[model samples]
Target: MGSTEDTTSTTYSDASSSPTQPLLSNPAPTYPYPYPDPPPASEPEPTQFLQISYNYGPRPIKDLPFLLLFSLFALSTFAFGIFSSVNRNPNSSSVSSFSYDSTTASCVKNATTSSTLRSPTFLPLPNSFALHSSSSSLLKSLIWTLVITLIISVPFAFSVLVLLKHYTKQIVYVSLPFFVIVPIFVNVYWFVACTVSSTCDEKFPLAYRILVLVFVFVIIGVIVWIFVVNWHRIELTVRIIGVAADALSRNLGLFGVLPALTLGLFVYFVPIVVFLVLARLNGKIVAREEDGEYYCVWKQDSWVPAYYALAIITMFWSATAMVEAQAYVISGTIARWYFSKDGSSLKRSLRSSLRNAFGPSSGTICLSGLLICVVRFVRAVVDNAREDAPGMVNLILRCCVNALLAAIDFLNKFTINFAAITGEAYCTSAKMTYELLRRNLLSAVFVETVSTRILAGIILVLSAIYAIVVCVILKAASNLGVDSYFIAVMAWVLLIVVLGYFVHVLDNVIDTVYVCYAIDKDKGEVYKQDVHEVYVHLPISRNSRSASALVARTPLVV
Candidate 1:
């Protein structure tokens, strides 16, 4: 009995203590299982440099600036040459402006031959530093201020909007008493201030006249509006802005203070000014319906750029004028101020400007001149095509554009009669937009008054007629025991062919990138453009090169 009991106990203990007991049980164990949470859907960040790669298509337009600047330099030099030749005592064509002291004598002697005579060339324009303000600060400020101010203002403005919904309510009845009482209080204070003995003299003239007019107008307008049914809600918008300013200040920091005011004024007054001017001068903006209100609808989506472009044009005109003014004015002032001192820098700068008037920097002036041609061509095409678009604004703007183009054409026809330097279209939206277009047109032109662009356009025409001649010459060379002409010159020929194709392709691709789709990402901000237009820039490329390993996996998004 004792032996059997011991065996029974041992067996039970062994069975209970086994490692596979869970398997033996009804439910199997689940050890080392994975996490229960679902994976989140999210996009990964792209390499920073990839954004810049996608910004400019293929390679940048480099030879363009060389062309534009060179042509400008050449034209100016040619003009001066013509002037010098005509003004020379004996009217000798031998006295050309291309005569530099080193190569001057040779140039003067070789003026008759196109092959030997060199076209004037110049370096590109120095990129200005003033554009940094809009770049470094404007975007940053917009980002920090936009959300805070707009969000906070929503409640108060919406409350006022709700109030407007019940226009016939007692609430509308009370606004009158407040407006009337406030004006009376203001009048009383003004009268008290005028009667004060110590401060009366300073304020008596302008203050009294302004206060009396305000008192009279406030009394009359408020009184008239109270009795008048169906009051215009548009007039109460100024009050909404005041409330919004209060809310914005309460919620956001110091930066938020100005956004409320600026945004409100821009939103309200931009249309006001646009419409008023269009009404007066017949500009090209048409009032169209959206949601319920009227807005200035441009013919093409690109025409919206006209608004911004006009503004940019005006702003840059002001900036350029200011820069030119300051450059010359400050330069002259410094020369006078430091007359007793060394004055070398001042003197050098003055001489530099004067020399630039007749020197290599005429390239920049010529570029400016060239922009005039481009602007006119584009304006002409857009204006003429959309001449019958709706709205008085469109009609007026079209007329203005037509006039501007005609004037430019007149200048082109009469002023030096330059057909070689004149055909134009551009996609220079902005530098950050990755549009780079420049041309060294003078290279072919000064050679024979025919341009490279013109030559490219005519290459198709010449190909059909001159192809037989080319084949014949190549055949002759092949037969002449000249082992293979291409084999001898393959490297240089390939390089030229590759580089020329590269430049043309780069220009076309970049222009397409800018006009069709432009994306600019700065800091953490993304700017994806839905509407694209012609933007002007002096061509430049980012300094990133040789980082192929990076910027390849994911495309940068704006």
Candidate 2:
């Protein structure tokens, strides 16, 4: 359903150019300083690499503004943590009295009791030590503090090593420091909350809460103001998504869609099933009856570590395989759309694409999965820690793990896209994908941020409606024989899986198409596109080298 009109041949150069000559055989003319000189002909011509890297590195000077901005914000957050801690313990009274008021005590109780699989429920402080602020309890708390601190530090330290080893640019490396400081800030924040409320209820005093509300309102107002101001750009982004959806619909017909959905669901559910098996093996998933209802619960046992270890291993395998397969399918579908090929061409490409993903790209995505495993392992640690005792240490550790998880997830999205496009391994593709985003920061941010939020919201709304309809039908059909809670849980889980499947499909298409667009635009001579105008009209800064580089850079593919 895309434009079949071939405006221009996929020609690389002028009409007078020899048919045998390659498009990028000659070095591009030199630009001003800071842009590196063209590599010698013997060096395999750096233009292609530059075109790939074009999307990544900008001069350090160009990123100075962002670095300074984030640094100041991180420092401010860190300082605020310290300030709150001091206010909570002006004379060190908190150190002597590990006591809580009734309100805080009830809040903790409710939080612990009402927790479910979908959310983290608070647990009261561990009773391993005495309740009094005795020396033994204090010493145990300090040891817990150090252990949690070390656990949190491990992942960040690994990330730092990764950045140093692979990414030399200031913009790439500088972001790590900000991430590292976040856990410290979180730790301090929790320390302050525990010191003040003793039970870690995050409610501030009435006056402070009012001030916080005012600040939040001001932030919301500013966000609204910005959205209103940039309505046109947002509209254009929506239209671009519409174009992508059209392409997706045509390329991934019922036959293609089912396979993609099956692959994604299999990958996702297999781990859960394996985890369950492991749980059962450890005798953790215990069945019990309460109030005439039968239900199952997970009880951690001594073999819990074994369960986690196996879960991590399976997660790496499943994620690697899933990501590789998804990339192949998505990229294959987009290739057909980009090239305006027939259905038969898609069929032809499918086998080859899958081969590429599972064959050559296995090791690369496995590396990516290793990163995912690390994040998951850390999460498992945090979850176990919290289950043992939900205190300031676990709270801070969970927060830090969540932040790192998000960062890794974001990185993986691009890594998959890069792997799809280049058939490179995970790390190489990640570097390349990051480079592209680095080069086209404005457009990348605009498209990804706006589209993800809007598309997810739309999908979730539809999913909710669908879930409600299915639940009503199921309830009515069974004459309400089934437990309503079980029905609701199944419906929700199914909806999420279904919605997530399509969401990821759309995500891959969007990423692939944009990468194609960037590469095609850089190449300058290709079958023209109807959707380039959408990107053209988006708000990229005119004066910045980053924007100009995107504009002036040649396409990566012929």
The per-model lDDT (C-alpha) reads: 0.33, 0.51
Show where candidate 1 strays beyond 4 Å: 1-152, 166-168, 205-558
TM-score of 1: 0.18
lDDT of 2 by residue, 388-434 (tens): 88788878878887888887777787676666555655555666666
Regions of candidate 2 where Cα sits further than 4 Å from its true position: 1-230, 253-308, 340-344, 379-408, 465-493, 541-558
Model 1 per-residue lDDT tens digits across residues 1-558? 555545544544444334232210122212221335535534443311222211111222322563465444434433433433343333122233233223322222334455576878875545534455434443443343334333533453334334433441433444544445544554666566566645565747766657785767777575566445424431332232222222222222212322333354346435433532332222223345558654433232333334444433433333332222222222222222222233233334333323322233233334434555466457857766674576878877778877777654333221211111111112221221221111211211121121122223222222222233333454564342232223223322333333343223222222222221212211222232211111112112222211222222222221
Candidate 2 colliding pairs, count: 9
- Leading candidate by lDDT: 2
**Global fold similarity of model 2 (TM-score):** 0.49
